[model samples]
Target: MRRLTAHERALWARVAASVKPLPGREVPKLPAVPTPAPAPAPVQPPAKAALAPGLPRRPTAPTTKPKPPHPLGASLDGSWDRQIARGRLAPDRIIDLHGHTVATAHGVLASAIVAGDGARVILVITGKGRPDRPARIRDELMHWLERPDLRPHVASLRNAHPRHGGSGAFYIILRRPK
Candidate 1:
């Protein structure tokens, strides 16, 4: 092979000088310096900091696992009146989403269901659409209730009673709060 040019040799020498030597070299190893032991962390007392001079600090609220939304259109397989009279079911809350737009209704429904407030049954009044003028909310309510965000709050949905607007509304069974 031809010898490297002067410029090429000089470049190689600079590169070699900057590079660290690989392991297994013949260089003598120096005695390892002993590292000083880490100082123990300062002890801190477990105490709540006072918010005011006289008042004690308020305790933090306990963490709780949120209840999952219930699915939509789940069958009850029983009579509504009998269930209600027997204390098995009671629709304590009602939300009328009749005149509201789809977006507004959806937001309201989601918020209502999630808030729960110890209500066992909630009546969602979605007015039935006429044959010529279809009620978009009525058709889409169940589909919206089935969504991941709202499904956890609703256990099941059924047609409301005649006194409760019949086909124009639905009964949303909210899951019992843990």
Candidate 2:
């Protein structure tokens, strides 16, 4: 393999600075390039502090609020909304994950998604939690779906209707396979 050029080494230095090394591992640093001392700039007289006549001062950037994640059904079209509202749409595949632990559920969901059988809509059932504590599986389902490989396959996620297990179930609308 050829040695990295100066440009490649410089790019690597920038990349290395941004990463967090694993425990007991150190990030390899690039050799420092010695910059030559600059020639002295000529001294100049100070100008008036007041702005030049008719020149408008630029406005400072506005502070933006962090928007919440988009609502589950927002991106879906009217037909999807109508079917979901009327509880008329039937799921093509049903993956019941009520009893599985986090790791097992994650693997199953990934495998099912990757090895899809042309399912347009999948109903995922995560059992409702006890009155005192929220269910871990239910909470983590969204997080799992957000993985890079799965997110593209999924179009939108909606809470299932009462007939379809209500809040304990989620309707995963898959994008039409191209």
Q: Pick the candidate with the highest lDDT.
A: 2
Residue-level lDDT of model 2, residues 1-178, one tens digit each, is 9977666776777888999999999977669844445759988979858889899987888799888856444668889978988999899888999779999998887777776689888888987898886788999988888888788787889889889999899898888888
What is the C-alpha lDDT profile of model 1 across 1-178, one tens digit per residue?
9976555666766676677777886544433334445779999997955577887666888799886644454345457646644545546899999789999998998888898588878988989889998999999987888888887777788778767777898888877788
C-alpha displacement of 174 in model 2, angstroms? 0.6
Clash pairs, model 2 backbone: none
Per-residue lDDT, model 1, residue 67, is 67
TM-score of each: 0.53, 0.59
Report the C-alpha displacement of residue 171, candidate 1, in angstroms: 0.3
- Taking every candidate in turn, the Cα RMSD to the unseen true structure, in Å, is 20.6, 19.0
Compared with the true structure, model 1 gives a TM-score of 0.53
The true-versus-predicted C-alpha distance at residue 44 of model 1, in Å, is 95
Off by more than 4 A, model 2: 1-72
* Model 2 alpha-carbon miss at residue 147, Å: 1.1
